[model samples]
Target: MARRPRLEPRETRAEATQAFLGRAADLAAEFAAGTPPRRIRSFSEAAPDDLRPALAILSEIPDLGLVVHGPRGCGVRAPGPAPLAVTDLDQRDTVLGSGEVLAETLRALDAACPVAAIAVLGSPVVAINSDDIRATVAALGPELGKPVVWVRTEGVRSAVPATGGDAAAEALLQLVETQNGPREPGLLNLLTSTRSPELAALAGQIEGLGWRVNILPAGARVAEIALAGRAEASLVLAPDLLGLFAEGLETRFGVTRLDVALPLGAQATVAVLRRVAALGRATGGGGPPAPPRPLSEPLAGRRLALALPTAWGLAAAELIGDLGGTVAVLSVPHLDRSHAAALGSLAERWPDLQIHVGEGQGFELAGLLRRTAPDLLLGAGDAVVVALRQGLPAAVLDPARLIGAAAPEVLTEAVDIALARWALVRGAVQNARPGYTPGWLKRSPDWHIKQEVR
Candidate 1:
């Protein structure tokens, strides 16, 4: 990232599928060799596509008018701090084309609010109905005197939810299309969606180095987004929103993209800041780092299993090791080239770390949990439910908590709280309804992660 070279040009952000099953070491090796076993689950359950997250991400941008062209239940009544409208397409409208309805929604939303820019998020319903979303946006944008973009997010484009983030970033870039321009020295773009005290502090730390920091997209004005190309470098805090967005900025606007791991703990934060200083060529030294908050590693002398998203899971495992814990199994929704760097680093430290790949395939997770039987299970969303059904003590891995200065202490306290409830959970589920096949739990976790024979 410190190197001053233009990014390699890549055209499309399209993806077929993510990497298949293997050990962390093996996956890393194959990835490095450009032969990672990319496959599909033949008997996989129906999973969600990019629409949910894509709409969610776009809706986070403050004052950005958003219209999802589908039924009222398309993206649902997502409660957020952004203005969102829906086309409310009915059966007749779907058959007759909702171009008029879409234009009306856009014009109404544009007229009502002082949105910096407007985006039309296409859903599966509209894609199947073949609505002309782009033409509608193009016709209305000039009349309204504002940028209107169409973010394609059919529920079948990609299994990886982060692809939604890619679509969101592309829309953000398109909304703020700028001409080629010179960059400012020590100007860094800290890309994040949520605002937290920890991240605010981290940004302060960077600013202490006498450099300019521009927080973009989320909670940012259109002017800040326009200055994205002028930043000397870009650093993404949200892992899912990383690769495609940063790469696009570099490719289009000559910004440097720092490919660093998420700063989960104090050590990681320091390492990232140091990289930033070196890259940004800081003249005003920020001096040595301050001591982190005093707290013991709650998972010390304990072993645990991790079921999380790829980037966060891998980084959390490394941090867990630093805190004196062992990660026996690392289960993630999907793995791809974006994870190659973290995967390579993790494989070296935890060479024996068992890598479980599947997106919401709970049977495989149940089997792996039973096989390894770690003292605890750290997971997120539905994966945590799968663990608890087996009466295993588990804690939800909140991405927000696993970042910044408070992460170490926050995560430790969460583990302690979950650990205290172990006996209660174990006893309560003894008479619960059965959710898994006992025989399946005895089989290999990857039994269902079959090779793509086609």
Candidate 2:
């Protein structure tokens, strides 16, 4: 058996949280340094405030649509005025049951709209009654003969913004399964979840391989996902949401699953594609076609740093090592002492590798990076800043943008692209005159940033 590392001393929850936030601030400062790029206007912030912007974006996507439950102060904003359907749940309804109202809402939507799927964006008050709401929707789904997905968005406590995306993906998964015939003989479900636009690019890669890709939450409807069992296999690109849907596919359809690490560099990508091809062969499905040209080379002999969540760090480390890159430092937050010790032991196994545990945010992490400057950094969200400031290539693997409702393979492709871009940037920088700076590196104005709900 592999020996586990000793656990680090436990910090109080409050202390750990503070450390996490502090590190986030440092990271944010590093990456978000230019004029803010345009962002999709959120429904929560729109109308009665101008809902038109949100509506306009939604209108462009013909098949996909949004539904808001509860009255106006619910923070449920529809980007536009395509067709408004609101449910008013009172105190009595909250204490007793909102199922009747929800059922009525579903019936109305089924009758009036040609929606591919219905996403229930709940308010704080409505979130309190989520179970009742979901039961109502589930009951109404079969009755109305329409696929309804219930997303619980009550209380603004969590930092992640992809719950809506998760709900959307789950609904679409169900829809696809219901509508499609048993999974195509050798077909595989590509479990992609992420709010990032990179999903669009990744989908193209899988499709290029002549494989049928079922992008959870974004592209396909609920009926299509219900038919996922028919697919011969499932690939989990993101570790965070892997267990949930993978287990479901296994239980319902007897589909085999391959839990590969998210592909980043050239070696990792080839390894993943090869493994996927193997799974296809095992299931009697045709393997991916041979590449027209050779893929990029591995990052052997390079010094790499990783600043990411604990789950992603472990998986990434395995891939990084396989590529022949030397992992000089890893900055992870919230790891218990035993896990940290185990990680440390694993690092020791690698020649010249170093591992550090702490919140992703903090002066300590910055200090460590200053000491052991790495050639690359792989992390989610704000941690990309450290790499940027230190002049190293960095990839941001935001979980919100990587998992839940989007296509998992797309997320994998996005990571591959980010890695490719970083490699390109590094090559260009090396060729440039010493002390040359890129245009994006120029400083910009500092906009007042709002606090995200924790």
Candidate 3:
């Protein structure tokens, strides 16, 4: 609500912008762990796609321009409000290197628009070509008088799409200059993906506790990020997405990160409030009293199969199970070292629940759903389309939406709505054809995986 003065964007280390290249193999390892053990196939469709997650994190800067450093079509097909440019790499450039083309694109974008910074994004082609993107940015950034940041996005290299968010986090933090004066008190930094009512509600809850929330890398301005170093602590809603960014802030600035489970259900929300209060007490403020539990029992007698990312899947599954819904299966985009504790936590509760870890491979999810036959299916993005065509009631849920004190009631109402429409959905199920063939799904969801390994 308050306006901050625009500051000059500072140039960063060329190596820092290129750091993602070194982490590519490590990023791919996130998928190595699963009940069945994940393996690369001939080809698999990224559930949410690779760029969406990075864009979700970087697109927070509505005023920034993105210079995609690959083929012309390599840029975002449906870019958010931010302006975009491309090197338009051709066969000639791929073989000979496109340094000049990248330089030219960067200059043109700087002269055309007034942007806080220009993000130089490397696509899979760029990675394959071994283009010197860091050197190009380092050479051209100062001349253009803009902070040129590199977001490392090699679609072929990253096994999990959420790793793109990690790239965006690393790149954006380069712009966060360290604070010099005393740290700001009663100021809490929150990393969240909630929009509108959910976001407004979360802010109001924090404000009621005499603390202010700075929701970052999601609709935050460059200037707002620049000032993050001054906050007392950082709170992450999507811990898996923002964990690296939080650590970067702590290392750059002295801001402590509130290491806690994301606030999904009523209990987690209360836990977050308590932690905020404990931090606020350092600034001479008290926390709100714990509220009554929103859900006393589970969802009547319904069973749910959820497909989501690791951290979100774990939290949402727990919440649903706690609320009385049988968590028959938990599907994740991928699992990595960070998920070790959460995996144990999940196993402790639902040891027998099958964990399907894969990219947003629709066929696999369809197969898992058929095998499990849960009462309801919940997941992120268009994967819900698969569930509906199977004549099962479904809902699209982001774990963030399940936050706040009223989360349980909201989830229950959502399940009720899906059940009410079940008959109508079943009636129309035959009308909509699934992308995959019925015979193929019946054959095996993981037939390709088996073939590749064999």
Tens digits of per-residue lDDT for model 2, 23-82: 222333322342212211111211121122223222222344445565555534434333
List of clashing residue pairs for candidate 1:
none
**Weakest lDDT window of 10 consecutive positions for candidate 1:** 3-12
Better candidate number, 1 or 3, judged by TM-score: 1
Global Cα RMSD, each model: 4.8, 12.7, 7.5
Local distance difference test scores for all models: 0.74, 0.49, 0.69
Model 1 ranges off by over 4 Å: 1-22, 178-186, 279-298, 437-445
Rank list by lDDT = 1, 3, 2
Best candidate according to TM-score: 1
By TM-score, how accurate is candidate 2?
Answer: 0.53
lDDT of 2 at 153: 45
lDDT of 1 by residue, 1-454 (tens): 1332321211123222443555778878877886454466656654656677676667667788889898888857335556888999999887777899999999899888889788888887875678877788789988998788878775366656667777787777775464335777778898886667777788888887767888866678766777888888898887665466787888988888887768888777877787777764555646656656544666788888887767788888887877788888888867766677888898998887888876767887787777778877887867778888877888787765677756777667767867888777777667777677777667766655655554
Residue 14 of model 2, lDDT score: 13
> What TM-score would every model get versus the actual structure?
0.87, 0.53, 0.85
Better of 2 and 3 by lDDT: 3
Shift of residue 36 alpha carbon in model 3, Å: 11
After superposing candidate 3 on the true structure, give the runs of residues whose Cα lies further than 4 Å from its correct spot. 1-38, 42-50, 77-79, 178-182, 448-454
